[model samples]
Target: MMDALFITLQVILAVIAVYQFVFSLFGMYRKKKKAHFPATKSFAVLVAAHNEEQVVGALMENLKNLDYPKELYDVFVICDNCTDGTADIVREHGIQACVRTNTNLRGKGYAIEWMLKELWDMPRQYDAVVMFDADNLAAPNFLSEMNDDLSGGARVIQGYIDTKNPEDSWITAAYGISYWYINRLWQLSRHNVNMANFLGGTGMCFETKMLKEIGWGATSLVEDLEFTMRSVQKGIYPKFNYDAKVFDEKPLTFKASSRQRLRWMQGHFTVARRYFFPLLWQSIKERNLVKFDLALYSVNVYIVLLTFLMTAIMGIDAAVFNGPNIANIYGYLPLGLSFVAVGASILTFMAAMALEKVTFKKVYAYLILFPIYLISWYPITFYAFFTQNNKQWSHTEHTRVVRLEEVVQSKQV
Candidate 1:
């Protein structure tokens, strides 16, 4: 019975691994050259902040210098539950700031929903709405690239996620590397294969009509993932725009990073539970590849758990059962395959870094530290699985005050 159970589990894991491996290969497709278009669509840029007085000003300054037409895009800062000078700073910059003091319905998702209602009530109309965190810095061509994406028939678009302070600490560097890897392997791959792309909280643009059609009711901790899943359910797939870059601040310490990831995993599991079955049924009923892919992606956390279970099971079988096991049956083949997997991962990371124009020498230490950082996610995700009901938002404090020019200069180097 145990042998049969082991084989069943191994088969399940092998299939899942093969699926992801195929998707990773899809990322190797050449990047589509982005075409510039006239800034025809007007955008209402929304920045949700919670006492983000330190970095909000820098974002406002960066928004002011966007390469897109000044009259075409308007910036609004939603100062959600802020007891600081965030609103004052926005007003000082000659921009509008919408302040919300609702302690009960806090968080970026609620703030966005509230602000959307306010925007809809106004006589002014916008073609789309773009979201950004208070600590993010947009490249000058950010809006322009989004405009091109819209012109190219992408209704909902996710801009490229870049790191503002990758060299700040090991935690930040790991986050940076992870984002780079996801951008190339996950986002770009999905884009190439016409699969659904995910919104990275910030740097996401939603057409006003799409927003009204779907309604931004994603009030989960990871509202971005919830919204993406909801949109997929409604037959809207977000497009990934590699040309549009948005620089975001990452957590500096492992504790801070783990807490943020825990919140994300909790939300991830919640979303998967809510949507997995529906997506699976939808995929089967409609014979939709997009829905099927999304359904599989939703349960990725479970796959991680299954991987841990497999390792534990193998260890138990070797220890408790004693003598040579299935692993030894293959002799050095298992060990050789492990080396191959490690080598493949290293090559993939190198490719991601090179494509993102990151200086490898500068981030070499972080590369060595990445295995520990990646391993930490397992414990965080495991804890988050049990405590998924805890919806309390633990915000990561961002104090990195880097400017857009500095980021741009560093990239050029």
Candidate 2:
């Protein structure tokens, strides 16, 4: 019985680790296709602001200057519970603004839901809604690419995420690496096999009708993840548009990064609690492969935690419990499996850096520290789920105001 349990433990870790290691393989075959815009489709550009006075103006200016036809899209800013000049800035730009000062409704999820409802009551509506954080600068051709995707019959689409201040600090650099890993492994990978991709909160779009029917009811700390899973379960898979880019500012400090990541972990745990089993059931019942894929993706962190926990269990059993000695060649597969994950993460980080044009000389030292940062996720993921209360939203501040021209110039140099 003891030997059997030992082998089973290694097998479990081996399976999950191998899954993650091979996951990026899906994107290896993904090819970027040039966008061909058939016609200019109308869009409602929605900016969700929360005390973002420092950078909202720049974003509005960037949106106003999109290379696409100006008449086809209108910028609408949502000043939800702002104690700053966010609303005034929006009005100054001659764009429509909605100020919601209710202390009760907060977070981007609530703000977006409120704005969608308000837009629904208007005399006219848009063909699709594009969402962005106030600190994000749209690439000049963003809407043009999205227009092409929409014209090509993509109902839900997610634009690529680029960092405006990757060199601001080590924290931001780590964030940039994580973003690249997720963009390639999950978004681009899904795009490769014609699978549905997910929205990354910002740089994502949805058809007006889809939200109306669904009601944008994703009110959580990680509402973006919630909305993505909800949409996937409903047979709506968001496609990834590589040409449409939104450059967002990353947090420059560890406190802000922890706060943001904790919110994501907690929100992801909560959404998994609500939808994991149902998604699996629906996928099987309806023969939906996308839903099956998401069912796996939703609980991935938990799966990692479980695998890690088993490794610890093996260690404890060997040391204290006097079970099978994990250090022995008899049962070292768990350790080997773990190294597989670490190696994959390191390679993927470099791959992401290469794709984002990050120089090896600037980020090589940070790459050594990258695996350590990922290992920290285990504790954060656990803390988010087991010790939970006061689900009110908390957000990271984004004041970096790097413009597209500056980023382009920096890249050229």
Q: What's the lDDT for all of these models?
A: 0.87, 0.80
**TM per prediction:** 0.94, 0.91
What is the Å distance of residue 342 in model 1 from its true position?
3.0
lDDT of 2 by residue, 262-358 (tens): 8888788888888889999999999988898788778876776675676677778878988765443334457776576667767776776676566
Clashing pairs in 2: none
The TM-score measured for candidate 1 stands at 0.94
lDDT by residue for model 1 over 243-266, one digit each (tens)? Answer: 789999999899889889999999
Sliding window of 10 residues with minimal summed lDDT for model 2: 324-333
How accurate locally is residue 159 in candidate 2, as Cα lDDT from 0 to 100? 95
Model 1: how far is 270 from its true place, Å?
0.4
Could you tell me the C-alpha RMSD of candidate 1 in Å? Answer: 2.1
- Highest lDDT among the candidates is held by which one? 1
Compute the lDDT for candidate 1: 0.87
Q: What is the model-wide C-alpha lDDT for candidate 2?
A: 0.80
Model 2 TM-score is 0.91
